[model samples]
Target: MTDPYERLRAEAEAGRVEEVVVAVPDLQGRLMGSRLSVPYFLEEAARGGFGACVYLLATDVEMDTGPGYAIDAWDSGFGDFVLRPDPATLRTVLPWDEGTALVLADAVWPAGPGGGHGPGHGPEHGPEPVAVAPRHVLRTQLDRLAARGLTAYAGTELEFLLFTASYREAWERRYTGLRPAARYNTDYSLQGLEEVEPVARRIRRAMTRAGLRMETARGECHPGQYEIVFRYDEAMATCDNHVLFKDGAKRIAAAEGASLTFMPKFDEGEGNSCHVHLSLRGTDGTPVLADPSAGDGMSELMRHFIAGQLACLPDLALLMAPNVNSYKRLQPGAFAPTGIAWGRDNRTCPIRVVGSGPSLRIEHRVPGGDANPYLAVAAAVAAGLYGIDNRLPLPPEHTANALADPAVPRLPATLTEALHRWEGSGIAAELFGKETVAHYARAARAELSAFERAVTDWERVRGFERL
Candidate 1:
């Protein structure tokens, strides 16, 4: 068997592929590039990259032109950005778009005109920076780690709620009265999984076929919610797998005549969570943060990473939970952290220090399943690096209810607060470039503004007759 990479290279070079999909992640983490014929991919895109509008970064999840963006406006003409395909990431998405191999792309600035010979826009001097793209942000943070002679590996526990209703049926019902695959809380129950087995089986097989490494699958605290854990890989690959797996899962579930949502707090029952587990290793392949003799077997480096997360959580909250509905899931006692705190093997804390030896890592629980893994992971890495660079002290682990402790800083209680923190955050700006921070913060504000103008059923029912 030729390893996957060799197979991809052979196929790409030999023109054996049909549709070569070049995908670049937008601010919302949605794959936002286009499908090209293999000839165009090989001739134009594989090296030179295709052109796309830069406003893709500014658009909200609703596709509304996001306000307050510093670039790509009516005045600026929404200039073209280069979608630089990374051929190394080419792989067949067998379960969904079979016969089509997809390569992830980086957003860069297009050259002046005909080919690379356009005046000053040579290979060495072209404007290739994608300052607002999430992948670029993650890559920047990863490079920071590399500069320290360290590499970070991360694994995410992806959770989503499965409903018996088909997507159309659920939408017609306005997401009401859809049967949960399970009838009660089924956390870690083998029997509980049986209830959602068909949907689960389809998802598992799809992800497996797509080459997503499945580590474990289990039920969560809610009736129909389940979590699939993947093996940890380097930060870039981990986040890439996260996005691909999620897109694959949605497609497979819809195909199976079932529907699932990663919406945090699908009603009041349970909020889907993507708990992140991360560890650092030296460039030489030795673990840097695990010391057998240290407290909880965590090196000072690990503690600093945790400390960094604690300090930066508020500013990064909007990036982790981009939507307004996401904050509703941050309620206390919902298996989600409400404050910035850490504990040894504690689920209640924002950062949970767990395992020992080769497994020594911290599980960051701040992000919802709705998070764009690229941004979330990037924020985590940036915060970790900040902690290391600043030599910030990791506070004593919290043994009590973090929400009840007034001393403990709360996770930004709303998107508004998060945007405020994000705008003023020196750490976040320093971590993920100031311009990128401002761009995303503007998008978040736009999302918030849209939410506020809408009158929901609850609003009408509560105030229509009473007032």
Candidate 2:
């Protein structure tokens, strides 16, 4: 196998690569970074790292920053954080964008006096990773699991709705009355996908060229909605591919003169979901999630892992459901999860155990499309660790529809409730340091503030006619 960096260097020398994008995943899982010239990237940035605004990690969807965040960019003069590119994430083949290669980066505080890349800063100085950054938050959890001789493997199934109208048109119309790619429900229908298949095919092919292994792709229940699942990998790599795919998919859609949305609930119909499938393995690659000797093929470790999810789902809800729109999809009858229960092959339950032997894993159904993959996966890993450390007993599985069972404990019903649970729970602080909890709590509060201050179309239409 050719070395990824050497291959990139050769491509740059041959004029086949012009730019290298060094990006970091923000709180919303959006990639934010700079595009460097190939020569500059291969010479300087790749060795010493690239600079990005610290606010990238502190801001909300609108890029507004304020106090109360762990980073507190405004108070700190909105300084810069170094974006250290990870060689493991380098992608040399981007079929969608020619002459461009992309690499995911980690946010780190600058070295030397006053935590700035000032005088005395040298290659010998070690920069500290930003603890509250989304990538680091996930890394912390993975490190915790590793300490216990376990590694996490995961895959995410994300769904989105595609529209025939271009993004510019969708924006001009205030995102209403646009034409859907499909006129009706086309779940698993090979016939009606002609409208969406063209753009979908481009996205699928581009992702494969970008190094993601495609597992499945098909239409979803809602009109214009589609889902394409990729094969599982190490937890961190899975999330890296997820963000890249999302970013590339939008660019591809724009080039195709179409628009798609991954918002949890676009309307009253079926909503988008990001069901996370997770399993545990030993450091040496031994699968430990299943035991054939057990009647159900669930290992003792697997039982505790499921137990942890039930115990911590409420407290960690904010991580999985980060936005107010996220709760709109989690409501009952929405085909998303509402109750905190686990069952074998149960879609209605928040935690569903499936597969057998090495394939055995727990599927967490709480997150919607709006979720930040790193944070959501981190919550799952942390919850499972909690269960393993305490040896929490697995509760009886709800064989029936867990969504309709009033007896089953419910997940946080709203972002407000989720935030309250997350901030108040000592378990959340323990699992993901106090700084991480407080940082995300502030983010959720920012989202709520933004929503409260806006007068929506629904409110205007109702009052415009009534009064």
Candidate 3:
């Protein structure tokens, strides 16, 4: 049983692979990239791929230059940082029409002779600097889980809405009298899915061709909404595939004249959630979280992990719900959980414990589909690791309504509160680093400032004559 790297190298050498596209997910969950030749990537750049500026991760959704990042500024000269390719993530891009392959890598301090290529776009010069990248931070958390003799298995349920054209087209038309890819709210309606079967089939086929094990695909709660479930894999791979999955889905959808949106709440009473299912396995591959005799087949370790997550849920809110629009889904009875509670098969609870065999795991219902998968997984894994390290006690299970039960803590009510909590949180700072945390907080504040300066149509409609 050779490792994934060896297999991928063989595949690449055999001419089974074409170009290698290097990518990292940006703030708005969009994959940003610069493609490199396979030979260059493998020989010289593979160990340390090309270096891009650190500001790539510092900006907002619009890529606007932001303020308050202590590391980068107009004066300090935002320098080039390294992107170290993770060969484990290499895969052939079967979904694309062209001959190409893809891999996900970590942005790190380039490790090469004579240090990293210094500052500029030129090659072969300078010394490596000390810096923390998002993926590297996540790898540290994953290493912590491994140290505890625990391996994590996880899955993400992707929910997204489909419209006929680009967002610009829809917005310019006032989103009125728009045509959905599907006709009605087709929750489990196979007939509706059939109407979009060409695109849906491509999504499944492409994902499978890319080596992702997809379980099911069906229509979701909203008119154009759809959901796809992937078979569980190792925690890190789960998040890696998620980024590729979204990119693949969107590309396939666009070819078929549809646009995929993972926005939390696209419209009033219409939202999509990315539910993550997670479990821990012992060294022998048996689930450590499953005990038939325990509460809901959940072991003490599982309880404590959930307890740690709940205790720090507020601080993790920013990671799970990154954008300003994401806060809209926090309202009750909207199928998105507002309170932090776990129960056996309870959809209302923030965490739902499911399965009975080795698959017994938790489904965290808090994250929106738009969350940056790297950051989201890192935050969750960090909290769970804290639980295992401290031997934290799990709270009593909540069988009743979590929202009505005042005992279970609720998520941050608004983006403002969430941002404040993220800024002040010691756990977040420790996990994400001062620079990363500060950059995101500053970006959020910039967005808030922009929103304050604008006057919306609603304001004029409600107060134009009265005020």
Candidate 4:
């Protein structure tokens, strides 16, 4: 419970720290990094580490580096920016080599007047922050919550596949001979999990030892897939823990001569997702959702929040399913959700109402493992807040399949459609601002355009000979 920044500094001073890895995600949601020695990190880099231009958060998974960005290009000289460390996220790297420390940074618009922008910075569309910086938006939303004398607690289920080796090796083999950690569909199968006991057990322990509040690890639906749940905590802390959990799992798996992937769907039969569970509490520490003898045992406040989530679900589609490939997992009959519906403990529904006593809450099943946790939380909180303010009506509980019934409201089916809906949405305007939506639309359009241009193996193999 000590200050993470202070702990990092102390570790560095005591010679217990080795490398300090400062990372910010690029367009593909892959963590990019610059490693620094503990001494230099504590002295200079810890405050504001150096980073490259707008391309970091603007490019696609291929690092293709160009599309819809109006910010940077070959003609723009591809300037550098500053990655300002968020001291609150500075934590010990328990699973890394020889006492390392890890810290996450906020991408600053280090170019503009009054001197925050980088050197030789030209005129931009103003010194606005990048839209892919989800954590930044979440902080803004949390400030609003704090102002309302409330606190947010959250947890997310990390579902991923454990392959026998690294992605590079699997790709080289044409994804043909790769094996899942398990042989059978494990869904709560003890004997099935026992087959991959080493990987699962070590993952839990390593994450727990690294200061993550790991709850339990369980076998998932597909062969070689698993899900890990953690105890919920303050919203910010939970996001921090989620990132650490992913890092620890991948490191542990690699150490065992295997690889772990959070890809939404690695195979046709099995898919990975990150289901986020959240609840709100008052300053006096009372649950907002609990009210026995009420409908679904939910209070008026709970109903209002749920209504807001449903009404603004479309606007939030981009955050919940951010990547282009994410839409593929949202199809019906895949155990994924594609509609705006809630039910009592039903995983098939996009939202599930849980708890009977003082723990009542909603669990959103829309987000995949590829989602940005900060942005997802921001979208949820914003929508819920709108519900509370407007007192929107809660729809009837869904008993049947939501996506199957055209009457039930459904979410966008593609990233491009979602982006268009988001741009015109009042929720996006209120929560993220108009300019933010416009900027992100540019990013989304570029990604979609690039994807449209690339011919896939399916097209080459299926149509090349016949068509």
Per-model TM-score versus the true fold: 0.93, 0.97, 0.89, 0.90
Candidate whose lDDT is highest: 2
- Score candidate 4 by TM-score against the native: 0.90
Error of 2 at 257 (Å): 0.5
lDDT of candidates 1 onward, in order: 0.82, 0.93, 0.76, 0.77
Stretches of candidate 1 above 4 Å error? 1-17, 113-124
Cα RMSD (Å) per model?
Answer: 3.0, 2.0, 3.6, 3.4
Ranking by TM-score: 2, 1, 4, 3
Identify the leading candidate in terms of TM-score.
2
Q: Per model, how many backbone clashes are there?
A: 1, 0, 0, 4
| Candidate 2 ranges beyond 4 A from true positions | 1-4, 116-125
- Model 3 C-alpha lDDT per residue in residues 1-467, reported as the tens digit of each score: 65545554666788776577877666655667777877777776676577777677667666766557544535436665566667788786556546677777666554444233323222453333323345655667777788878787788988988887765676677665567778887988877765567778888888898899989989887888888899888878888888888888888887776677888887785688988888889867878987888746678788888887887889878878877777888787677888888788898898888888787788888888887776677788888877766788887778898877777678997889999999999988876678778877887786777778878767987999998
Q: Summarize candidate 4's per-residue lDDT along 1-467 as a digit string, tens digits.
A: 75446777777778888778787755344566688887788778775565656567666566766544544455456666567777777766676455777777777776555433333444563434544465667777777877887778888888998878676787688776788888888898888765477888888877777778777888988888898898998888787777767767787787788888897866677678988888999978888778887856888888988998888888878878877878888887788998888888888788888877777888988989887777777778888888888899888888887768788778898998898899788778887877567667777777688889888777888999999
Candidate 2 vs 3: which has more lDDT: 2
List clashing residue pairs in candidate 2: none
**Between candidates 1 and 3, the TM-score winner:** 1
Model 3 scores a C-alpha lDDT of 0.76
Candidate 2, residues 294-392: lDDT per residue as tens digits?
998999999999999999999999999999999999998898899889999999999999998889999999989999999999999999999999999
Backbone clash tally (model 4): 4
Better of 3 and 4 by lDDT: 4
